[model samples]
Target: MRCIIMSNELTKKAAEMLLNGATLLSEPCPYCKGVRVMKDGNALCVNCGKNLK
Candidate 1:
């Protein structure tokens, strides 16, 4: 098996999305009030267990 490495630019973008809450678009989780939300189809919070949809 081979491993894939991410570039600095890509890593920065991902970090910005996860840290800056851009992916969540300023929407906080209702359950735990998490600021960051992953860009999944379900719009779930990463900090606590909550679904914002």
Candidate 2:
């Protein structure tokens, strides 16, 4: 029996693509624009889950 393992470089490239494909808002939420926003990790909007950069 033989098994093939993926390389770390390949895994890293895939991860980068996924992250880049995601939407990254440069401005604030229209509803709560100008309000203070914080990063909680992952792709989530600070005001309404709109995805932050």
Candidate 3:
């Protein structure tokens, strides 16, 4: 298994999303296979550190 590390920015983003009531999704990101979250219809990739569809 491979270990993944998130940068400070990504970590902060995830925390912010959670704090703002974003829902963490079970599906993985298609680009990098990272964990995803959704908020107000926006999908964000916590591992890849970007917004998804």
Candidate 4:
């Protein structure tokens, strides 16, 4: 349902971020326990799709 759509969006965002040179972090996201990425000193949660600090 809504979660599926959200997941798709998150996947797309993660792919785009990675393609743009974002680094996939080894640590997990604190909020959703999902994979995290970093680029230009910013962190992003691939599952939550949130731009974290």
Write down the RMSD of all candidates, one decimal each: 8.4, 13.4, 3.9, 1.1
Q: Name the top lDDT candidate.
A: 4
Error of 3 at 46 (Å): 0.9
User: Each candidate: what lDDT?
Assistant: 0.53, 0.41, 0.80, 0.86
**Residue 44 Cα positional deviation in candidate 2, in Å, after optimal superposition:** 26
List the pairs of residues colliding in candidate 4: none
Query: What is the per-residue lDDT of model 4 for residues 11-38, given as tens digits with 9 covering 90 to 100?
Result: 8888888999999999899888899888
**Full candidate order by TM-score, most accurate first:** 4, 3, 1, 2
What does the lDDT read for residue 6 in candidate 2?
29
Comparing 1 and 2 on lDDT, the stronger one: 1
How many pairs of residues collide in each model? Answer: 0, 0, 0, 0
Question: How well does each candidate superpose onto the true structure, as a TM-score?
Answer: 0.39, 0.29, 0.77, 0.85
TM-score of 1: 0.39
lDDT of 1 at 44: 53
- Backbone clashes in model 3, listed as residue pairs: none
lDDT of 1 by residue, 4-50 (tens): 23234344544666775546547776776755446555565555434
Candidate 3 weakest ten by summed lDDT: 1-10
Better of 1 and 3 by lDDT: 3
Give per-residue CA lDDT, model 2, range 1-53, as digits (tens): 11113234333443554566633345655664622233344444333334443
